[model samples]
Target: MTDFDTDVPPDATPHVCEHCGRPFARERYLALHRGLDHAAALSDDERAAYETAHDAETDDLRRFRLLALAGVVALYFGFLLTYAVVT
Candidate 1:
């Protein structure tokens, strides 16, 4: 394995930034991407593709977070209802 790969933990996969094609050892490289290369980062074609992928990922994350929040709320209510019934 290369030095970059070696630096990354065994459980983590190395990611190349879709925008800049820079190999990042960590997943949190998105924050660096946003800060460093957000404006002049990508070629026109790459920019379009990156935007599409970013939007899809954002939408998926929103959907999953909403689902998780709903599950937590339902579980909380379920417990409250059971407690009320038991008491």
Candidate 2:
């Protein structure tokens, strides 16, 4: 099977950070997370990856919020229309 197979566990211990609860398969990830979150000492590649992931997550949340707002507005407008028709 390929390395990305979900059934296979990674070689390193599954250590999760106390601050973020982010699971890391390698000890190096703890250092990386500490540097990025607490120390602001991320390498260029680490910074780039973090920024990219953050942007994607932010975009997803924004889209979900917008959709939820739209649904609420539509429901409110529908209620108003029904009330107006009935009265």
Candidate 3:
């Protein structure tokens, strides 16, 4: 293999930061990094992309929390029902 190939890992991130040269597995991560670490240096397009990614991540987190809450509620009711039947 070539020297360049040896430097990169087999599962290296495909998305790379333009300013800092950091690698990310996804474009969203790179956008977030750029926005947080290099905010003043970002162009209009980059800033927009970062906003979109941040919004998406926020929405996803909200959904996850809702799902977890629903799961806990369901388990609590199920256990109560089981105890009622046994007693």
Candidate 4:
């Protein structure tokens, strides 16, 4: 239906999930497919562990982003501090 479909290679259309061997149009769709379709099959303990691990990874990423932002701000102000002293 799309105008550029013929222009793109056939292999570029579908994204496959290695875990569930399912095809999706996008990576986010594949992730949603696995999380929704495949997750119900996991045991209660497995689901709990998965949720906990996801939470830990999210927390770690948040901390890393905040720290990086802080470092950038510090560096920017440190440059300004030197510039102010020089001028």
Q: Which candidate leads the pack in lDDT?
A: 3
Candidate 2: deviation at residue 51, Å? 0.7
Q: What digit string (tens of lDDT, one per residue) describes model 2 on residues 1-87?
A: 122222225675665656656666655555556556755656676666666656666788899999999999999999999999999
lDDT of 1 by residue, 33-86 (tens): 544477576567655655666676788899999999999999999999999999
lDDT, candidates in the order shown:
0.66, 0.66, 0.84, 0.66
Q: In candidate 2, which residue pairs get closer than 3 Å at backbone N, Cα or C atoms, i.e. clash?
A: none
lDDT of 2: 0.66
The clash count of every prediction, one per candidate, is 0, 0, 0, 0
Q: What is the lDDT, from 0 to 100, of the residue 81 in candidate 1?
A: 100
Indicate the TM-score of model 4: 0.55
Please report the TM-score between candidate 3 and the true structure.
0.81
Error of 2 at 83 (Å): 0.4
Off by over 4 Å in 2: 1-36
Better of 1 and 4 by TM-score: 1
* Candidate number of the best TM-score: 3
- Rate residue 57 of model 1 by lDDT: 73
Per residue, candidate 3 scores C-alpha lDDT tens digits across 1-87 of 122222345566467776766666777888998999999999999999999999999999999999999999999999999999999
**lDDT by residue for model 4 over 1-87, one digit each (tens)?**
222222334668776655556556665454545556779676675556556656666788899999999999999999999999999
